[model samples]
Target: MTGSDAAGRLDDDDFPAYTMGRAAELIGTTPAFLRALGEARLIEPLRSVGGHRRYSRYQLRIAARARDLVDEGMAIEAACKIVILQDQLAEAQRINEEMRGTASQESDLPPG
Candidate 1:
């Protein structure tokens, strides 16, 4: 790939750039922890050509949040569920804001 192409990928939060080990190290966790998160269906890592798990920055953030919940004495299963619900709620709120903005804009238009 061209240098520009490689540089562009640096800005991609979803790009599977970090290996499993690196991801775990960056998040101060273990490989098994990431595997457990996957098992719990919390975050699904992409597979490299050699069939190894590759995580993105976004996935790492989610994993970090799960790790925090687990550290707070929450069960792994419950932590995963809470993270999933949190994601869903955040998405719903974003959509709601967008819809409200659109409706407000429509209301400001002249009656036709």
Candidate 2:
């Protein structure tokens, strides 16, 4: 896939794209900061067969949000917490959708 500039929608082809240093350069952050986020579980790094940190476009977006929160004067820990909560909320929403879909499917079925 062709490269996408900032604000462009990333595709699966964007996966396994950025190495740690390159990702740091693209996000305007240090590799240490990215590692810290990984330690905090804010962003899960994709590990290669040799265990190197490979970042995806989606992970870069998370890093961008963490950077934004830090620049807004929030502490890194607080920023990490916000990111975690947002992830949990997204998971909850996904589960709710699945449950609702199951209910709908059941309603559409004939009585047993």
Provide C-alpha RMSD values for all models, in order.
0.9, 5.4
Global lDDT of each candidate: 0.98, 0.87
Worst 10 residues of 1 by lDDT: 41-50
TM-score of each: 0.95, 0.69
Model 2 pairs whose backbones collide: none
What TM-score does model 1 achieve against the real structure? 0.95
Kindly list the per-residue Cα lDDT of model 1 for residues 9-102, writing each as its tens digit. 9999999999999999999999999999999999999999899999999999999999999999999999999999999999999999999999
In terms of lDDT, model 2 sits at: 0.87
Our tally of clashes for model 1 stands at: 0
Q: In angstroms, how far off is 103's CA in candidate 2?
A: 1.3
